[model samples]
Target chain A: MPTDVIMPALGMAQESGKILRWLKSEGDAVEQGAPIMEIETDKVTVEIEAPASGTLAGLRVPEGADVPVGGVVAVILAPGEKTPPETPAGVEPMVTAQVPPPVQRTSGRGRAGRRPLASPKARRLAAERGVDVAALAGSGPHGAVLATDVESTGRGRDGSTAGVPRTPPRLGAIWQRMAERTTQSWQTAPHFYLSREVDAGRLEAWRASTRKRAGYERVTHTDLLVKLVAAALSEHPHVNAQWHEGGIVAAEEVNVGIAVAVDDGLVVPVVHAADRLELREVTARREELVEAARTGTLRPQDVGGGTFTISNLGMYGVDAFSAVLNGPQAAILAVGRIAERVVAIDGHPEVRSMSIFTVSFDHRVVDGARGARFLGTLADLVEEPAGLVP
Target chain B: MSSPSAVAAQPGTRELTLSQAVNEALAEEMRRDASVFIVGEDVAEAGTPFKVLSGLVEEFGPERVIDSPISEAGISGIGLGAAMTGMRPVVDIMFGDFMTLVMDQLVNQAAKIHYMSGGRLKAPLTIRTTLGATRRSAAQHSQSLHALVAHVPGVKVVLPATPYDAKGLFKAAIREDNPVVVFEDKMMFAVKGPVPEEEYVLPLGVADVKREGEDVTLVATSSMVYVALDAAEQLAADGVSVEIVDPRTLVPLDRETIVASARKTGRAIVIDEGHRSYGVGAELAALIAEDAFYDLDAPVRRMCAMDVPIPFSPVLEDLTVPTADTVAAEARRLVGKE
Candidate 1:
């Protein structure tokens, strides 16, 4: 079998890279570690070496094409071996990866009473854009109209290449699903937001305290908050409850999703069984999950399951605000920056560092009283926080 | 921006004007994915100051078509909030200069939200802002502040000079989970070309060569791309072959493209609209010096705006920023024009 030279993951966060040029063209012999091509990521441009010694048999993606990570862009065949057959013109060459096929056939209906099978996200995108999936070529793995294909600007407005503007393709199915989920959460949940200003002085003070920084792992206040929320959710399982079958149901495990901002969209990867892990384990686990999330190397198991979530904007110094509850998760806790504000300290006006914590919950699962109790418990624990960690 | 090679290589994909392409991409993305929403000043009811968001409100509905208060800070904060809670919000900050009001949210807050949380949270946000000097928008309103955002770790910055890139890059930015700031040059808004009606994404961090020649390389950004193109045309008349390089996305600055072009040409001149001190020109020049130093025939020449604030007067501003004439003059000088 010919060895495929796929687009290398330049950085864990990089999804795609541009092919500046092919150092080795078709029929050119190469060796492993030989500079084969130049790839540019969002932050750095590095040369990718040939994975193995072989002749450049075929260029799956042309010079200047932007290909996703793990997507095959070229083929390195054994000496004198033949390249694969040419793909149909105007269609994107298929990547050998396991991604579902790109949807083709611009017409929604196909011959022989065939209904074009597409991902629910892709179908929804097609319907919303009025795009006939059958009419276009599928760039995805198998002949599926990938969400990227649905928004591709293949033709100009005048139906002619002349004077026509190239429109960029739109968001994919993942973004569409995220939007729908948030919309559903906002629409369904009787959301009553309560914002509180906590004394971040203690959180910050603890972070500075030598006791917290005993090793290589530097646990942030956000990490502590995740642990605190997990403990709180485990203790008060009501907040970890989910809405189902016309009634509220609670879960036993506290799998908390940490909302991480990536280049394209937010991905909340779950810290499975957060309540069970000690603070040190929680810190290490959070690091591993975050590394995977930002690099887009997150496995299905890394992101797929979650029961509660935490979002911290405090480091960015957001004074205070409410977050939209990511749907299905019973509650989402928003943490704001630790700012020094004048408050009554020992019955006297004093400037003390404070951080705001806002929790947006699915009101159907937990009432205001219960929600307040959760926040109150969180506040009590966070203010001291020593009890929960030990 | 328009590149001769990109135009030549894919003559079919280079026709749309940058702004037209942005509008088309936004419209297409919004239409296709209900999850992608645009919230910016004058984006909805007012159709956008640059008219890029025209008819978006009617098409995507007000829920996705959000018009906000004149507060850049407030709107940016709102974009952050919406992004954190699950929605991908694309914000337009009217002018690049006004981004200062919200830098706290963008540079400090939006940029570091993910890493600081040790991977527990992410902010998928895109801020679209305008940068150029020729519109006579004057000192405060017209500035290329992409360098500021580029300095932030979590934020990805993309600057588009052509319609082809604007649309594709915008689509990519909307899909990114980290905060992305796209710098749209005011002058390139009307430079129309052919853009495919179908979906395509121009990945971030890639550079496109608008024109190719041998003697010298002209690396430009935004409106300066057009200026460099004009300079290339003028130099062609003089038999001096100048290669024009557009580093489309400045943060993921395409060092390979710049180095390749520089190595091929042996000389490079960076043209930008920002003030000369530590601007994008400085960064590009530094990279070339560090990586492609052996490839240079002469020291890398960076032709940028003078170290002075943008003036309200047209004549003063004219003298302050780079013009096609100055670019040609500088290119000619570097290539021994005088």
Candidate 2:
């Protein structure tokens, strides 16, 4: 029997993987475990290996085709073995059994018979609400009708007026996944935000001194924060825990995910066991992850097993912002830009570098008191980072 | 048995498995009417494989809860003859796959008796059968053939999804003047649900809104009812509110309720365990399209079993029928979420 080469599932929640390219051509003799194709999932792109040592035949799916997880992309047949007449086992036969010819567009009556692809509900709502569906562009696949399209008829996202329909711009894979994850977090995870403004004088000095060292020239405040957050998280295991199926599960390893903004959207790549890694190691790992994220070549391990996330918008010069929790994770720490501020020190006006740190916690996992204590620990570490940063 | 008023006032207080509910309904009916009796192969003691009629023989004795030969046709013919002569016989066909054998007595004879005899003759017979696959019974034992009997006019078809509906609908079937075929999902016999202790009868051809929502209407029957409900729950997490309408009865299907739900939601997906082509789903989809076409936002979709025979392998059998995930995916597509 021919061995079916299926689209491997790399991520836990991945449904499909897009084929990047076939490493080997059809009828090529290949050894088992040899990389045959490159497939990209929502999380990362990885090379798929040949299941058996055979001549690869029946390459069913083409390059760039997004086949579902476990779906057959090709078959590996023994030498002189013919391609079977029936579909390979585990493949949906119904999907391959029939192929209807594409409909050709005709003029006059044929053209008049063709209607805009809108859902039945959308059409009904449009009629009930006295909205012209034809005038509204759909956001659904192939411009099909959507209930939202009918409800929001005559109003575009940019507040454009009626008569001019606007098709919503398509989102890339990362951006779409980000949207779905954020929406899910917002809807399901009850979030509670705790904000604290800490003196960044010691943190800045630590970063500056660390940058002066050889091979640590790129040490950043975010990297310093990752180290500090990891230390504080080790002390506060409750904050490092995740909300899993209505219970708090303390993650054994404090894998801190750094939110990196790529061209497409936000991608969080984890720095595994940040608490154990040195400041320079954290910086090096962050750089590698950010680079991989930007190039869309992040491995599955780079994005998975994140117990907590740190999103630093300080580079953008933003004063302060609270982020949504990266769901399942108990908390996410958002860092703001460090700026000079005058404060009364011992009843005298003194200048200090101040930065606002906001931590968003999943209320189900971490309570207000626990979150405050964690934030207090983080603030203390930020104020006087003597032994922690070194 | 508790009084009808007591149970009716606080229905669904008591929980019972579908098996227990059906057994209770039979015992209640036989006690209420002396003319009512049970006839099937091994139903007297063995309870017909699923043990749905266990202990019924002790309550009504062997004469009333009689066991018959393995011939489905013979038992069905006997039930039809007894019904015509004034007995309300509840004929038990062990598996719905065997319903094909009783077609002559059920469809040709029982279904056409009243009409052919100019309303002078009536067959107050109820055939309790089972439908649904994934039982590893292979093609011969596992088949959802309710659509076959439902196609005939004189006969009525009711599928009970819950224990409450199972008991109530079974009682109503016995009281029905015309021939009624009750197709129960054999796998659901052990499924427990809230059933009132009091005596009650659910009217035929009435649809039950198992769960109410607005985004889309899932018109599921029998085994598919639970599938649709599971899908609805999943879709709810995605922010798509799905309305589940279970048309407990198929023949005199409650077109009004089904159509109204489709109109209200503007989308409908009919789910059935029968084969996709010419199945209950196709008929429901057609009815919704014909009645609620203008109100619909998407074309009516049908999620039914594959046309192939139910495979014997557990892995292969699972693929032959619609599941919660598949139903949810289809619902998501209709609502424009996918």
Q: Identify the leading candidate in terms of DockQ.
A: 2
**Residue A73 in candidate 2, Cα distance off native in Å:** 41
Lowest lDDT 10-residue stretch of candidate 2 chain B: B1-10
Per-residue lDDT tens digits for candidate 1, residues B165-275, read 788899999988889999888777887766775679988989998887898899988778888887788899999998889998887778999989987776789988877
Query: Cα lDDT for residue A81, model 2?
Result: 86
TM-score of chain A, every prediction, order shown:
0.60, 0.77
The per-residue C-alpha lDDT of model 1 at residue B208 equals 90
TM-score of chain B of each: 0.95, 0.96
Interface RMSD of 1: 22.6
Candidate 2 residue-wise lDDT, B1-338, digit = tens: 11111123244468788899999999999999999999999998897889999999998899998999899999999999999999999999999999999999988899999999999999999999999998889999889999998888889999998888999999999999989999999999987777876679999989888888999999989978888878887899999998888889997889999999998888899999999998888999999999998787777899999999899999999998989899999999977788
- Interface RMSD of each candidate, angstroms, one decimal: 22.6, 2.6
Predicted model with the maximum lDDT: 2
Q: Which ten residues in a row have the lowest lDDT in candidate 1 chain B?
A: B1-10
How does the DockQ of candidate 1 come out?
A: 0.01
Q: What fraction of native interface contacts does model 2 preserve?
A: 0.90
